[model samples]
Target: MELITEGIKKAFILIFTGDREIFEIMLLTIRVSGISVIISMILGIPAGLIAGLNNFKGKKFVISIINTGMGLPPVAAGLFVSLILWRSGPLGFLNIIYTPAAMIIAQILIASPIIAGVTLAAVQQINPKLKYQAMSLGANRWQVLWILIREAKLPTLAAIMAGFGGVISEVGAVMMVGGNIKGQTRVLTTATVQMVRMGNFDIAIALVIILLFLTFAVNLVLTLIQQKENITWAQRFWR
Candidate 1:
């Protein structure tokens, strides 16, 4: 009761007072998650488009792998990334362990599959006839692909939101790879965990509040874009 109230108060203080450390954590969280989602979109959208629209051998196997990746555990991703970034590991030459770069890498791994899976589903749901119609009209492969992508833009936005949400809220993998160093790789989620472990429930709750607010803000913008697109699409359909 008191704890909750105190935490709420602290959250407002931190937000309104513009606490430097809190702001840094918030920015880092956004920067890491933002970059991760963008990279994931670049990688995932193409992979999903290719997998969904094309026919080839072992397509089912490829899709199965993507589906599996969508549900991959954060801890497992962390372990895998940690192994590769560890001093004795294969990619140790880069020496990015415990850095923001490492956190971004882990987040990308966590987010890309989710975006890809959702995108794959979205593209698959499109009417196949559209592709044939475009092709018959002399549209080249690239043009056809563009048209299909435009058609799926709304759902693709949803995929981006999902990817952003996944990585923004993630803790385990980032914590593992980033080592939660203060003023460096510390992010909202990892910082919250640190506060909790230190029995600073008020601070932890404040961090949680900030995180929820951040998530809501980003998703709200995305949702607005999505709904606007929906209305535009409906108008076009009616006309």
Candidate 2:
């Protein structure tokens, strides 16, 4: 109880005082996760759309791999990324280890599968007849896809939220790839770990509080946007 109170007080102090380091860490967290999520959307959305819309040979196998990747262990992802970026590794010539770029790469790997899987599920849930109907109505391939996608927009937003949530809360892969370098790649999650390891319990709690608040703030905005078009029973009070 005492620790909680002290930590809350400290968190207020840090936030109100505009602590540069804390703010920087928070911003970096947002930047890395945001960029990674965008990249994931770019890469995953197309793959998901194709997988969901088409029934080709080995499609089930591809979907199974995507589903499996959705639950890929963070530590395993970290190790895999580390190996690929290691000094003597094949891609080491790019030399982006222990940096924000590396963290974004790890995060993209972590987030893309979740995005892709969710997107695939969303698109698949649409009526197959809708595609044929649109085509019969003289809609081109692109137009048909657009209409189908718009129908699944609600769940598509959910996929985006899920992807963002996954990467923002992730710690292991980012830490492994970023090395948590202060003023460079130190994010909220890694900073919390570092604080705990250094026995700064109060500071650690403060960081945790900040992280929770940050996550809440970002998701709250997303939630608002998501529910904007379709108010749910639970959202009645908010409306």
Identify the candidate with maximal lDDT.
Answer: 1
Candidate No. with top TM-score: 1
* lDDT tens digits by residue: candidate 1, 1-239: 99888877887887789889888998999899999999999999888988998899999999999999999999999999999999899999899999999999999998999999999999999998899998998889988987888889889889999999899999999999999999999999999999989988867877888899889999999888777744554356474
lDDT of each: 0.90, 0.87
Residue-wise C-alpha lDDT for candidate 2, range 90-112, written one tens digit per residue: 88988999989889989888889
What's the true lDDT of residue 215 in model 2? Answer: 76
Residue 92, model 1: lDDT of 94
TM-score, candidate number 2: 0.91
Query: Ten residues in a row with the worst lDDT in model 2?
Result: 230-239
| Model 1: residue 155 alpha-carbon error in angstroms | 1.9
